[model samples]
Target: MLRVAAVKSPKIKKIENSPPASPPPSPVQLARAEENRIIALAKLHQSRTQGLFVNVGPSWMKVLEPEIKKEYFQSLCKFIASERSKHTIYPPTDEVFSWTRMCTLNEVRLLILIQFLFFSVGLCFSVKPGVQRPPSLANMYQELSKDIPEFKSPDHGCLTGWASQGVLLLNACLTVRASQANSHKDKGWEKLTDAVIKWLNSNRSGLVFILWGAYAQKKGSFIDQKKHCVLKGVHPSPLSAHRGFFGCHHFSKCNDYLVQQNKKPIDWNMLPAELMKENINIQN
Candidate 1:
């Protein structure tokens, strides 16, 4: 015990010589940072809201990225908190519901793209889910066809035009209408007619214009000149038969002309054969 040497004291570094380390950001701090970024972007541009449809932005897309899933969470919060969340665009019908499920499972982006495109063009705008049309486009279509006996066929309506084609389809329809508009005054019939004609004149060629019914026929003069071929005569309404609008042979003639010009056969048989037969029978 007496032989023990004095223990040497450990050298300690002076506090002034020590290096400082950065502090970690708290969760609250990180969340606030993200919110600030999103808010700043939202201020730069606000998307338009149609009935039930919400136009998502690139920021929203970024938020959905798996790495930055926080953005998605924030977007969901914003969307759900917004008044538009309560709306429903689809019907209760099992068929439409089933289609919606299928679209969700397969082509969510495609469906959203379509709605966005439609909103941009000002046609068939979406409403909030579950919100019914006051006069409803369907009701309006029914009313419009009420007096037109030829439009008695289930498929012979405006809604059919909306349902059968993509959002861009209406553009084709409108183009056909515009090419025929001789003057600004002719634009008075309906905005859609004017839009169609304008679109057609700008994008000519490779477009097939179907001019059904007397109204379309009367206004189809310009389209007749511009299109590869215009299928004219009665509107495929059942009344077309009694009105002598069908069996003009223009349908087949136009199809054949298109084949000759384009070096390809026109598939006028896109619709069900039975529907085609019904149209032909009514016309005859």
Candidate 2:
């Protein structure tokens, strides 16, 4: 064996020039990064509002039930974020996923679900989740008040008042573009809302569900009619409200069912004391 000297390779110095500034992120990549950021923010919003929300939407939102913290809700939030960043148009208060927090979670005896955030009126007036005074809502208040007399008419503060009485007001499709109906349909919101409905039907007993319109009624099909009361009616939209919504009497019917179930009836006349007084005076 001939002795051979091994040549050592020269050591090259490492050069780090800030990694080319990441190529300034291509348009597609910038778009993707933005999408990821949106998703992260949406997820963060969900996390921050979890377990008895710490100031998410309004005073009402702060007291939302623990449902907001569930896995289904988190998944929905991520999907919504991703979808919105891609193409879906979100409504005004993207943070308020559902109109929950009428009362403690356990106190909820009824769930009211509509198809989507009916934004027909939202284009004209800013919709502040718990404070929206759309014509449809006003019609509901009017009709229900006419029937029950105690159910207060729609005023500036009546929306929150109604929510504070333990009715979980939810929309199957949570968001849509302004003036566009069901624009956000099939965008993964149904799963979350459906899960909420199913959870209530299974875990809780003697609950009342008011499923307005064909879409909500369809989504509510899985509810066990044997365990809960499911009330179906035409949506209270101006287009079809005259067809059946006017006489649906869902408010009284919901209260009646609650009584039958031995649950305290939701006082549909949920106006604050002062507002109630003013309302009465106006009527007088």
Candidate 3:
């Protein structure tokens, strides 16, 4: 009983605390993201490669007909043989069969046949110019001259029916070629359109597409028309300015639009008054 009366319990204070925060994303999460990015890149590359084969392969095959006859088959055989000496890179069954097939074809006969067919058509046209007439070469040249006035020689005053300025501008600024009726047949055009679309998708930027003629207008429809600002007009024939293809008052408005956007003008030397006014507006 000596000090029991004065003994007292120590007071305890409860420490208030916040819950533990989640740890930063672990190394595993970072590695997974990297893996996904690599897979995406691989898929994109595969898609591009397949697209190239589908659009361009047949045209390339036709163009390479000569090379195929002379050296391609033999070269493939040699490469396969070389690869076989090392560990097999290609399937053995497929390689052996393909090599055997290549060696059996009569290359010389095929070449002669193609050459004969080409010359025979030339001979037939020359012999029967009237009854079996395809368009005359001279008439064809004349029509082309009309379509492209720049073809007029210096001695020729203006080539009677041709429109000079419009043809010149069109040729200089835009290339219009005869494409196959089937859009799929124009591989170069397809590839260019595909690339532009891909770039736009990735960049999320606005694009302006200028279509100069009916043909181009039709082709533009195949693309993602909504994604870009498309400006369509006639073929820029000399008549276009008078007919108000886009607008007579602003014949060169497209050029002005481009310049204001910090883009290059279609033709700097031929800047119309409307374009100059736009330029002044931009400066002010």
Candidate 4:
């Protein structure tokens, strides 16, 4: 045997294990998400007015009825003052006061009762529009939750609970004339709504949606139904509610959907009505 080549073989290096690279989003998904993002940004922030882009829905404008008597609003001013004096409580946000003026006492009461209930809300309509207000009623979000819990006596509480729960309260039409229901019919509200839908489809998934009417259900097709909970029923109004809304038990149903998704159930209860009596406006 030739001893001329006794050099040690070069040591072999072992390759360390590493995480596999994540696959890139498919072209379809990428295209969809990007397209959605662009549409959402434009929808929420941009508009075409008289062939020019106008900042319509995103930055709310308060166009109070120029025709209504000052006394109608003055009544609200008085009511607001009375509430403040009676409970030493005031609307937490300017929106609280403004929407309260638009809402009935029962509506406000219902608004406060959704605290311990569903963690999300889906709406068929925007609350209202005004010169200084966004086309949506998202501003009164906080005050709506100051009063109720999800478990018992759940109410709409100015939709504050839904607002707090990050609900998507959308409207096909963004601008409604104060006294006219169809004033904004031709104002391109449908396009604005499409933008919101695209934004939702792109930005989030596995959410709970409340589709309480034909109009709401119509929008359902736009959402990612595969990844979200879509709850449907009649509109929450006396006219159609008898068709389904009353016994829908949507609050509990919504919470149930949340739990199924491995989410913490909405903290439907606030302090017992007696404990927070002072700050609450519902105490008799």
Candidate number with greatest TM-score: 2
Q: For residues 233-264, write the lDDT of model 2, one tens digit per residue.
A: 98877888899899888888998999998888
Ranking by lDDT: 2, 4, 1, 3
Candidate number that wins on lDDT, 1 or 4: 4
lDDT of each: 0.32, 0.61, 0.30, 0.39
TM-score for each model:
0.33, 0.63, 0.26, 0.44
User: Taking the candidates one at a time, how many backbone clashes does each contain?
Assistant: 19, 0, 0, 28
TM-score (C-alpha) between model 1 and the true structure: 0.33
When sorted by TM-score, best at the front, the candidate numbers are 2, 4, 1, 3
Question: Which lDDT tens digits does candidate 3 get at residues 146-228?
Answer: 44334332221111111111111111101111231121123232333333234333343233444555655654554454544
lDDT of each residue in 231-281, candidate 1, tens digit only: 554443344433543335543454465466654433322322121110100
Error of 4 at 56 (Å): 11
Model 3 ranges off by over 4 Å: 1-194, 197-206, 222-228, 237-251, 259-267, 270-284
Candidate 2 regions with alpha-carbon error over 4 angstroms: 1-79, 82-94, 119-132, 272-284
Task: Assess candidate 2 and give its lDDT.
Answer: 0.61
